[model samples]
Target: MKKLISLALALFMVLSMIPASAEAAYTQAPMLDGMDLPPVAERMPVEPMVEDADYLQIGTYGGELRRAADGGNWYNGKPIEEGLFRFTTEGVAEPNVAKDFDVNEDATVYTIYLREGMKWSDGVPFTAEDCVWFYNAVCLNKIDSKGIRNCHKDANGNPAVVEKVDDYTFTVTFGTPKYDFIEALTVDLKWHFAPKHIFEEMVQCIIDGKNDEALALGKAICGMEFADVGALGKETLYYFWNYPGIPTLNPYVLSTEEGKNNVKGQYYEYVRNPYYWKVDKAGQQLPYIDKIVGVTVSNVDQKLMLLLDGTTDFETVGMESIPTILESQTQINIYEWAGADWGATQIHFNLNVEDEHLKELFNNADFRQAMSICVDREELAGLLTDGWLGGGQAAPAPGQLGYSEAWATKWTEYDVAKAKALFEGCGLVMGADGFYDFADGTDLVLNIVSVADSGAADTYKVLEPYYRAAGIKCTFKDSDRSNIDNDLLANAVQVMLAPVTNIGDISIVLKPNSMVPGYATNVAWYGTMDETTATGDLLKLIELKKQLDVTASTEERTAIALQMLKLHEANQWTLAYVEAAPAYHAVNARIQNFLENGVWSDIYRDMGIAHCQCWFIAE
Candidate 1:
């Protein structure tokens, strides 16, 4: 008996010496140590999102990633912003910030379940209230001055109601069936939940009509005063990077104080969020890199040099830079991402032009078809992209969803005789100067406006000779980008040449302005019709848009989108020079885990959907 007791005592002693077995915890970056923050497990949600995709490599944490931001910090914003859901390479909306979600039978209600313990960068718990607050304060109240968007409403035009179910769950109920609402939430960044705790008091002040108090609170948060509460709220909420104190759900938070002032030649830095709520398969907290450093390069030359020298980690380059990248191999690795742009350079003739004759000509299907077939797209493609990209119509590519061969190939054939005949059919008379004149004997001169110093200008230059050969007189009007933008907004642009981007199958559904009309971005048809005049092709498009609004299934939505494109094809509303081209991005070889051939889509959030959290710098 004494020997048995001794044996048990010995076993206890051994177990005690071995130490109590604690729960396995995730390993956070060493930089987070001694920060007086919670443990990795505590900081994470109840069930932290595990990024264990086959392509993901367990990366070591340390070192800073250097990237160029020629435009502004906003260029870097998309990669970091987290919405309720994220777009997949296939343009499907998958779970992201929201752990899971459910839709009712008719799809009028969406119940979103967020991660239970997820916290904002500031360590405040993120809840359904944040989303509800945004709906009530911003959407319902129109604090941003942009009234409730059409998508946010139902068929009856009643605003969607957001109701909080619990701290981590909420439901959005539309007055009518909104089947594509989940995709809508994924595509639109404005719908993402805001940090209500940060903005509550100021919002209350604004709601109470205490303008002075609201301005003071906003000034304290943003470090700048605004002319009004609306401007103040928008800059503070939408442009959160400019005010870093406002918490973020992003992997990294801006560490630089410059904020909005981090302009050309200035540098900006982003530090990894210690409270980031994701982990790799190996149980290491992400993002793998310690920091992201944004450096400004004034020109493409400087950018190219930086890329070759490995001073910058990554930068998107055009096909024109392919030769330079190949010649100077250095430490740069080049790969192509499937481009989403449908029209490399598309022409939009203002259908609402004040000149009656011009408007009639622009609206005439034969006249538009004549202009389209006049330009030799094959030669234009060669001149523009050195034959890298093939000539295509003003429609989605074959590989893209919603692509219709019948629609895409329509009016795309290069036939000068056919074009001239069609022009004559439209009442255009051949004049003494080898140019066509209007039916009323007025000189048929079109102002082909484009943003100055842009690729659109180059396209216009190439198209000028074609237009001249086709007996169409047009003057290239290169205007400032801001001026062109203002004109587009005011529907004052007569004939504009611009890149028609983000026209992917899913993108078109979200931003249908390019084809459906009635939007400032729809320079082709903005102000073209009123309630009385909305008929024929426009009426068909509007009805199709209604179907798209309530379409839940991806297949049905795609079908509806194709129908809309068919209308445009039949009408020849827009003209195209080149089709979608593959996008090339150069990355420093040291940048590990960067997606080599990810889909390059603005709708898919570019690198944001590439799992940037898994990227690391090789030692």
Candidate 2:
């Protein structure tokens, strides 16, 4: 399993000499011209990441990029996330923060090389110690260690041993060979390094049992003080944006404080980092845009209005909004990115419902089959998304790892007679109210729920008649998204309809929450598992997920994944509709160098790898 990525080899071979004057080497944003800052040559890494690739255009520096992120959580932290490595548009992993890395034989040990002379946004030198501190001190702290991040653990559930080899080098050794370690690093492990200078003393204070000192340090730096040192470290470092004083390596740093930003208006702002490490082809510091301005939007209508009125330069829109956006004749460039989704909307029944009658019915395979066949998938899709989604069955999309045609079409056909027969087989009888009643003659009414603002109610409204024709009564209920999650965890939801998007190629293994039980995504079987009570298929899925985690061989991992999918096909744990619709995001026509035809995936971290640093707003 020995492998090496030598992306920085060519970079080191032909190093460009820095000009005598800072102005000659690289240009800075006009906003920073008079600020007390180091010269560009001194601030940047000795071998800075050069953006001379043909795919990106050299952009001019200026203007604020107005983006709409609900509640100022910009792109779910994508814009500010700079990981150890990043995936290219071609889906290949490449070095980013770490210049290069090497995996030893059997893939148990990884040696990472950091770029020299790299500095945090606050001008403190970033070194291997920072990486080690993040892994050992913060992540594995004795006070409140939450254990290693799921992705960072190896197949055997063993955490890596992070050690600093030198100022610019570190090694991570796992107990077993982790073949897909690179993907794990690239996908989920953002913030591979932290600013040790800022947080180390506070952590030390906490570790030394000086609670008061730790609190004072945290409050003095970031205006954050938590009784628990672990929680304090986690919040300040993991969610660095909320704390203005936390240094970062990202292109932009949060410029607004908590009280400074309007609470009612819900505004947040970011300014370009003067010490950012990347440079463009023309020797200009990257992040062509000088600042990023974001606002919290109450609804999609507000988002669409911002797009139309030019208040926001970029925003992600749903496929259902395409018709409305097209009719508006707005000049915003709607980028139709290829979606990596198994289904747009899916249904899950609570297998562990507290009510015995509902639980027994939901667990009946025949009842579920009847439920699936009764819905006219195509009609529902047309009514809901204007036919933009093309309807679906309960299966993986064409390019998904374990996709099969038979599975794709299984139990998807609309056959009222077959459904009625299946219902009869389940001992359900037609009632006076034109709906089915349980075996004991009790009337059945499924309370369907979904995320409140997700437009799922409209989908459920269209689906009501289809279910009614099948002799099933259902009422669509709406609640806050968080409340819906709480309901799922509490086993309060009888049926749930929601969007399922983690269908990207690598997601089969990396993100198996929807397919595997115990997680919130598969809340139907959330608390129904134990040694004796676990179903054979459920046990098989658990085993397969474990195998997927540690199996380093891609071929072996795919084989295991297919086995799990086969079990899902036989069991029908969830039903699907409208799979693999194109994902849309609107950008101001003036913004340049944004990637086109990108694959929208959670594994790819959405827009994190889209080279936003190269995007410029044209005059």
Candidate 3:
């Protein structure tokens, strides 16, 4: 096995990339105003991936791409900051920082190989030690870890163990077979590696109980740019934005200027990372653009205005901005793509509640089904997506692995009599004004909550009167996104009507938090194997997930996946789903290798941006 891997590595090094076009084989990089860089060949990985000459044109390296930061997930700058194993438009994993990988027959162990000479923006070698440091010191460490480490843990409560094979290769082994590793690694670029040389000393000091010294050194290490925000002091450096000293594998590096504030500043400037490893077919280092300027607009409206005025080059088409995008000039290309989605708009019931009647009423499936029938989805879709997208439920949105068309419209019809039947069955009666009261004639007001920013407040404006027309009096409440999350975690929430946490990847089922909530999206609704959280009808889901964890057979895994989807289907625990609209992107003609039709989801951290390293400025 070792000999085979070594031979494969040699072949990879000698591999020649042939671009579709017979163009010049090499080119000089754009001269930086005051900076000098080594030749592109000297800086790239030993085996630079030759881009598909068919999809992308071989390029000259220059020009800046301008964009705006719409305070949304992915399709933002997350791609400019690339990941190790990037996902394609179809969600297939492609090596970027990674060179290649292999799995044992049973899928219990995975050996991932890194590109030789892969370096961070700071020109430090990226090796297996970095991967080990990140896994041990940051991810698995109880005190310093921020992630739930759920994906890395097994059914028996054993975590995936990490072992370094060499400077360039490492193996991750789960107690059971974990087929979801590939999908999980590609999502959100959750590559578990970092520059050990950069963070270890100060981290060691902190571990040794030198508090003040560590704190002071921590601030220094992050440099003062991230000092005020404590970006440097973060447990993991994955998102320590603007900390120039923080080494990264992304194609671009954040500006470290003392006063550079992405939020307050007019724009945040990201420069090309000279150490970027990929090259075009013509052998030029990748990311043809010299810089990317993310215009910092305070609100979505301002961000849209920038795109409309032609100051910004690209952005996702917010459902609200469809008309504007359509009316734009011919220079801009627009395309519709489905997000890897769990569900869009969903009304969450706080299962763990203090208010007795409200809790019983919310936990009632008949009442929940009634609420689903109240809204005319055709009209709601028209309002939210302008009739461009439709057909959904509490189940996974279309195109996800186990989506069943039969379950989509099961109870989605706008039937007043049927809704009245479901509501009345839950011990509710209508008053003279057409609104329902309790069996004891107590007026019922269902308060649905949401975060103010996601336009859920606006969605509520549409749903409030709609529900009232169905003899149900419901009100809308808004809070910050963080507050809503905190409320859910603390079990203080009553009802949350917001975007159902969409799963952009199949790994979501393995993690299984959002749609089914088996493993803690927020105080599991059905319950989980973990004794701390309540267990419910969803135990089958937990069992299936565990079985999938240990089962090596693909056929068995697929069958189990289908079973899990069926469980969510029967439960209807999540009340309803809104349409999954195309992630709207307005691209300028100057941008090359931009996919007109693509799957853009945050399931892979900023899923659509995985192609960003391949995207370059044609101007």
RMSD of each: 8.7, 4.0, 4.4
In candidate 2, stretches whose alpha carbon ends up further than 4 angstroms from where it belongs are 6-24, 74-76, 141-147, 201-221, 224-235, 257-265, 323-330, 350-363, 427-448, 468-495, 499-507, 518-534, 549-552
Residue-level lDDT tens digits of model 3 in 1-619: 3213344334443453333342245454565434676655556666656666356666667877787754322334466555567665544565656777888876778898887777777877888999877777666653232443666665676878888999999988888767667655654236677678877876676567666666676667654433222233353354544445667777777666654434236666777778877777657776778877777677778777787777888776676676776676546776666565555677777654666687677667788888888778878877776676574676666666767777777788887788888988999888988898888878888777777767788778877777888888877778765466556666667777764354334444444666444454544242122334335655556666777767666688778878877877786777655755557677776777886666655555543343666676765
Question: In model 3, which regions exceed 4 Å deviation?
Answer: 1-28, 33-36, 71-77, 142-145, 205-214, 223-236, 258-264, 328-330, 352-359, 387-392, 396-400, 428-447, 469-475, 503-511, 520-536, 606-610
Instruction: Report clashes for each candidate as comma-separated counts.
Output: 0, 1, 8
Q: Whole-model Cα lDDT per candidate?
A: 0.74, 0.74, 0.65
TM values, all candidates: 0.87, 0.86, 0.86
Candidate 2 has which clashing residue pairs, if any?
Answer: 155-550
Q: Per-residue lDDT of 423-472 in model 2, one digit per residue for the tens?
A: 99988989888899997889899988877766787778788888899899
